[model samples]
Target: MIDISQLNYSSADFWQQLTHLLAWEGVSDAAVTETVRNILADVKKRGDAAVVEYSCRFDRLNVSTMAELEIPLNRAQAALNNIPVVQRQALEQAAERVRRYHEHQKQDSWQYTEADGTVLGQQVTPLDRAGLYVPGGKAAYPSSVLMNALPAKVAGVKELIMVVPTPDGEVNELVLAAAAIAGVDRIFAVGGAQAVAALAYGTETIPQVDKIVGPGNIFVATAKGMVFGTVGIDMIAGPSEILVICDGKTDPDWIAMDLFSQAEHDEDAQSILVSPDADFLRRVSESIEKLLPTMERQEIITTSLNSRGALIQVADLDEAIEVANFIAAEHLELSVDDPAEMAKKIRHAGAIFMGRYTPEALGDYCAGPNHVLPTSRTARFSSPLGVYDFQKRSSLIQVSAEGAQPLGKIASVLARGESLTAHARSAEYRLKS
Candidate 1:
């Protein structure tokens, strides 16, 4: 059951309570960091041998050689035919929607010229290779495959590599099918920190990628953090989180179920509801109790909700919105009337679901938006994974004689101001003609 109070709570107290009900803090434990550091060091020193060793230790699978780790294209294709028609159709539809949405985000090279013949522009180019890590231990995430790989394909990345851990040496058929449809160039059976290391440092079988974008466990995240300079990474994702803003318009069952969606993901996952209605809070709390016993992952959800979930009774809708903004949740739902109106006021959130009908699950699977979003309040500064993750931009500038004179003078002045005589001289040289 949830604690409900209508009393005007202090901002400090509210934030403190909210922070306690979040999974962000626990993902970066000292032990986890130390373990990841050792794994990365071993990989850096031993390369393929260390990757194979860690794969055996962590995944409990024996991958003897780099050759044994690479998934055959024929096997991946065969898995597509093995899946049910309806499931394959659904995946195809999701992939199509994801591809179409990201297609719109694709950027091109552009240039603008001044009267003096100075040309300034930006040139956008897709990365040569991208690595996508799909988690396979707790559950199979075919949706993650579609979300990560489809966007890279849309961005025109030349090569797409996917990695998943399978203790039995058998990857999920649905995962392979989704990868096939999404145009993945390669698939590998390696996972954990080793998979990340193979992608970052390129084992004999796995090619080094320009960018690595996907989700995994803490070890995978730490490995990405360690290899950041060697290769680009999307973000060090934390556990999933959801924040619901309701105003008694929707059923309590719906609200409770929505909260459980994230909670069931992991014991450390967070779920919170901020509402002005005390009765609604009570109803949702009761609904959660009723719903808990029926779910297969009831224990996980109960622990998550008890430890990291909250039912905050705010004085008003404005207060609720304020709290939501401060939290910067990964998934935000406005389950009130005129959700669109409230959406306008929201400045930070990875994804926003409007009205009572749009559950977070819809966005997770078929809503066209990538589900790989920033967690741990990073919605304040970061964004969901998309086509942009697979692309890079470089500025382009060209100057004619007339354009050079004026720009050179300004550059020289600025360079001299910074006490860089060599920079000033370079600008002066451009202006000499």
Candidate 2:
């Protein structure tokens, strides 16, 4: 049951209430960190032996050697072929859309020559290799496979390695099919912190990667954070979240169902709605009650909504937009009379869904936008994972004698001001020569 209040609440009060409802303060226990640190240290110390041991202990699989870890190419292909035609078609379509979107993001190496004979530009290059971590325990998300690998493939990464846990010693055929569609170079049957470690520090089997992307559990997230400096990581993702701004025009059942979509993801997942209409709020509340019992994941959804879901009654749509901005939700759905018009006012969402037809689930699967988005309040400063994550940009500068005189003088002055005599001399010598 959602509490509805229309009184003029201050920003601080609103924030406090939202925080309480959403459980903004995450689990702060050090057990996850301590465990990950110990695992990382073990991997660093014992190498493959440590990983193999952890694989058996945590993943409950008997993977003793590198050969056992490598998923055979033929096997992956067979898995792809075995999948249903409709599912394969869906995965292929999603892959194409993701590739097309990322292809537009690809940057070319460029050079520019000034009138003074100075050449300056930028060089964009892809990393040598990338690792994608796909979660396997709770559910299989081939969508995550496309979201993570397509960008790296479009960026022209030389090698793409994927690691996923398979407790039963069998990987999901759909995941393999999706990987094949996305041009994954290798698939390793490993997961969790050990899988991350195997990617971070090359094992006898898994190759070291330049960058790591994808979503995972808390253990995986901790491992990624631990090995960040050693290898490039997308971001330490938090729980899933969705915020809807409704003007009370749409059916409350639709709104209630949409909010539950995210809530069912995890107990910490946040779902919120900001509406001005009292009737709409009451209807949505009733809708949630009626709908909660019908879901297969009803228990999970109920726990999540009870702890993190909310329906706020704002003064108007403008106030709703303000509240949304302050929250900086990962997924923002504008279900207003004019969704496009309202979207212009939103500046801090990871992905904006406009109109009554565009649900957040569409973006999660096949809407051509990466579902690997910044979660929690990080949408304020971060962004959804994209092609840029797989590419690196280098500043290009070349100075001719004519261009060197002016630029070198400025550089020398700045270097001298910073008291770096060697830097000043380097610029001065370039100008003189």
Candidate 3:
């Protein structure tokens, strides 16, 4: 049912084919940046009034005051109580796992004293407040609430503010329930560039946040890009991605559905399968045809596969690793025999789903690793969202009189070489008798 591109490692044009597939055509055009610029400027100037007006115009919600947009704790708690028992249990379990995993990632402050009495180390501290932006237009992502807020909480963030748009005043109880479970300090019923501006610039009702984290639409991404220097932001994530390296041992249907999991995200998301078994590649393609009709988002998956997906035939697992490293996919699943051994060869990937039993969907939800990962080959240099992202490090230094004797000379030499007389004099003044 899908017409995904097929490539073989031995082909002369394989590199060109791969490069063409990797290209991202959605450059933020001048019109989008101009619109984002206008929104940011308007929100900055008018504050709460501009935010309310934009919400009314875009979300179709007629509200006059900021208090009407503030969601109370009782409402979030009520949502938590109203959800189905099974869903609640699953959410609690996932939260517990995510919390447990992140607790290990928490950094601590330490220092060491040298013989000359110089003390140097790093002091780790959490941000004062964090803003979370969860997409609420098409489908609600409660997992996002757990993923973004829990890490901030674990990192000792003083306060957490969450913003989810209620289009037409329709709020998703699952999202509220997850926010309640995640311990979000405050909740706002606004979204898009207006919400981002509020968090970046601080409106009358919404306090400014030190960093904003989560996923959003193109407009929200643009706003985050524009306001990054004002307030820290998580990466401007591209479309979801999943790359599977199969050794032809796992079920072809599982591989087909694994690809579908990310492809179903949107028409532009990418899904790739690299395998040594050429016949297995054909079988998986047939499985794709057989199973594509059963999916609810069949149209999206089909387009994504046909446009951005690929089934590559490599000579061996080693060559597959080479291709995967070059791609630096957002989600890489190793459906091979010795996944741990194969993983040592991979240097670039946002997250690695080890072994055939592990699927990328588990990581998206209950697997305890952050689903907010690097995309567009940024995995080559970037990392996943974690407790460390919400925390900062300050270099600590204290030079005793004896210690300054040697350090002052070095500082003076460096400062004079750079022609900074004020710095050289300052260091010279610290020299010991």
Alpha-carbon lDDT, every model:
0.86, 0.85, 0.95
Clash list (residue pairs), candidate 2 = none
Q: Rank the candidates by TM-score, best first.
A: 3, 2, 1
TM-score of each: 0.95, 0.95, 0.99
Cα lDDT for residue 194, model 1? 83
Q: Write the residue-wise lDDT of candidate 2 on 183-279 in tens digits.
A: 8999888888988988998877788998888888888888998899999999988789999989999989999999999989988788888888868
Deviation in angstroms for 66 in model 2? Answer: 1.8
- Candidate 3, residues 1-433: lDDT per residue as tens digits? 6889999999999999999999986557899889889999999999999999999999999899889999997899999999999999999999999999999999999999999999999999999999999988567999999999999999999999999999999999999999999999999999999999999999988999999999999999999999999999999999999999999989999999999999999999999999999899999999999999999999999999999999999999999999999999999999998999999999999999999999999999999988899999999999999999999999999999999999999999999999999999998998865
Candidate 1: C-alpha lDDT: 0.86
Where in model 3 is the C-alpha error above 4 Å?
Answer: none
lDDT of 1 by residue, 101-205 (tens): 888888888999999999999999999999999987557899999999998998999999999998766568899898888889998888888888888888666
Score residue 66 of candidate 1 by CA lDDT: 70
TM-score of 2: 0.95
Cα RMSD of all models vs. native, in order, equals 2.0, 1.9, 0.8
lDDT of 3 at 335: 97
Model 2 lDDT, full chain set = 0.85
